[model samples]
Target: MTRPAHVLYVAWGFPPARGGGVYRALATSAAFADAGARVTVLTAAREAFERYTAVDAALEAHVHPEVSVRRLPFDWPAREPDRARWSAVRRAAPRVWWRVRKELDRVSFPEVGYGPWRRVLEAGARQVHADRAVDLVVATANPYVDLVAADVLHRDHGVPYVVDYRDAWQLDVFTGRRKHRRGSRVDRLEGRLMRDAREVWFVNEPIRAWHAEQHPAAAALMHVVANGYDPQFAPAPRLEAPDPARPLRFGYIGTMSRQVPLEAFRAGWAAAAARSAEVASATAHLWGHSSHYAVEHPGSSSIPVTPGTPGTPSALPTGGSGGGVVVHGPVSKTAVAEVYAQLDVLLLILGTGRYVTSGKVYEYLASALPVVSVHDPGNAATQVLVDYPLWFPARDLSAEAVATALVSAAAAARTADRATRQACADFALASSREAQLGQRVSALLDAAR
Candidate 1:
């Protein structure tokens, strides 16, 4: 028990990918290393980063120094419009799986792009285990296919597996939709893999509750590990201490894809700006990827692209003068707190309701900044931030209500009590991302053995 466990973690988006899960995965693996595990992370390669999402060098540095990572190469450039050179599949991609590809990419998984990565991933898992034997195989999902990779090692080499489900595979946590019908291949596969795993971890309580109801047999294995601020990226001091002078700089960081409801924020902003022109003189800056391939995903907002998508400080909006709205693009994970520091307000904008808990929410709370929520009432982040001093929850999507709420948030920002502020800091301090998972991973490792 005193000696370290050799853990091989299979996560599709680790480090460079700029996918939100990268932070959790990096932190967990790094935490495992800290908790005395000799960790070998079998993650999708740096090439995968340029293909699926933008890269974040700063986030890459956040990976623990002791952790060893193996980069697997993937050819996703075929999905892009112009890069049709190497594979015949790329040239024929248009006709071969045209309809399904569009549909899969539309919904963001299963059909195109990530679907083909299955074999590459399975091979990568085998390569890692073959290179060296492992005691535990942990897989974090969302290319839930990564679980297939872990299953390869488990089924073939008896490397016991744990499935860390940051978000449910088939269940739509936001709307409680099936995301598709039951008994589908993917759903059945997910249920089967989940059933066989040593442990299944989720990021929120409501999500764990829902899974328990669905798979009561596996309920005992399900555990909640809420996303917390990474010690590496956490703000050391209260970000900018309520900067009110030059427009109360409201900010939204992370990928604002189609589901993000940036337009809703815009709708809210339009009304709120007019109502409190004096207060909103500050800009609403967005930092993160606009879409997967530097292309605008169907529902993503077209805004300024600073640093330009992959840690390029993006901000680009086509029309409406964009006077109050700015897209700062993506920021490096290293400078995240510095980014957090400059903003007086944090905007928590997301699409779903069933039980969504964004990784950014933890950092937002940790940033010690005022938060303006544009998510559903049932959203898990709301549960965590209900006690926050300057939280403005837009229970419904009405622009007027959100506008009014913005005014209230502005008022709170101007005059929140010191104790309320301290309470906010205390709450987040207890939930440091690396620290929480360090404890959970210790238990998971013990159980898997």
Candidate 2:
């Protein structure tokens, strides 16, 4: 007659919020629900996603029916584009207004856009706890403000909390540099939070090590929980032998941020096409949003591509050398499998960073397709793919290096047998989302007992 452990999962980005971190949040919550925990999620309102970022309505279906989600109203004045709603000060002396706004926000918490949300989240957490006692609190961060709710509950009710850092609060993952000065509000706040946390989780060992170095006292509590592919969203491995007559399809998924080496990829694709007949006939598909936001504006970093006619590639400029490049825009999470199924090769083009390991890498591995990694060799993702049988990593981001990798990937696509594809898929089985979250969930629940 024992009741299920009540778990409070706080995340800034959830389903329909088309950010890169949304997938991990979705899968983590779902994993908790599947583990028989009474899961409740706190996230921003649907309007926030619809207005500020792009929304994927289809992803809503992925949420487990048993899990309850409560959306809180978020105030993000910085991202507000509607000038009509702005005050005179914001319209006239915008810089001064922003400076004042940031100062006011930091009065409550150290973060700018998210600091003001601390009180709102605390109130929400208190209200949730009042209804039914929360057994454990798990807070995922980017805005890092979500951690405040967990901290509030822990301080007020003696509840244990877990801080799940999707990225660092004080360290810039891309540059491996400290974002805040010593003794600053951010540093003090992060130190206090980590010191009080029951456990702190990071996406990779590098990030964990970095945080451990910063917080030696809490080093023993830190753990690595890598981002793994969700089985429901991953495409089945393409086991069929390649038909030389049909052109191969190379694809890239996830956000195309400003840091992504798109120009290098373009040049490399063209050069690879000129050198290899298989690559010459192949088409490259770019899926997902261009930049972090879906709303297109003038001078945006998004690559311009005409909407393609059915059964034809989009009119994307390839310098008149390579195979056609098509921009399919953002694909729905529900339709991920379908899009990935059509791709013969997965392109892992990432920004240069030793700590950058994208979630899409797991999906690419699961696809069992030949992967062409057009990123820095020093990237953390390279380590993950080093043992991958079908991975073709570029030596560098240069056009020649990328072209070489692309050509090799193309060759693999044409010649790789079903056994080789299966072996690659087998290698990825250990990295499934369920596999990654299962032990963690059990440990947390057991601790709650």
Task: For residues 1-449, write the lDDT of model 1, one tens digit per residue.
Answer: 45567888888788777767778888888878887778998877786677556677666666788999888776564455445453566356756656655565435336445666677788887887777677898898876767877788878987778899887876787677777566776766677787888888999998888778777778888888877888767765363346445457777888777677776777888798888974457667777766655445553564333332234322222222365776665667777777776667788988767587788888887867678998777778878888876678986777887787777777777677677777778777767886568667878677655
Top of the candidates by lDDT: 2
The models' CA-based lDDT, in order, is: 0.73, 0.84
Q: Which ranges in model 1 have alpha carbons more than 4 Å from their true place? A: 1-3, 86-112, 237-245, 294-323
Q: What lDDT score is found at residue 179 in candidate 1?
A: 75
How many residue pairs clash (N, CA or C atoms closer than 3 angstroms) in each of the candidate models, in the order given?
A: 26, 0
lDDT of 1 at 334: 77
| lDDT of model number 1 | 0.73
Model 2 per-residue lDDT at 172? 82
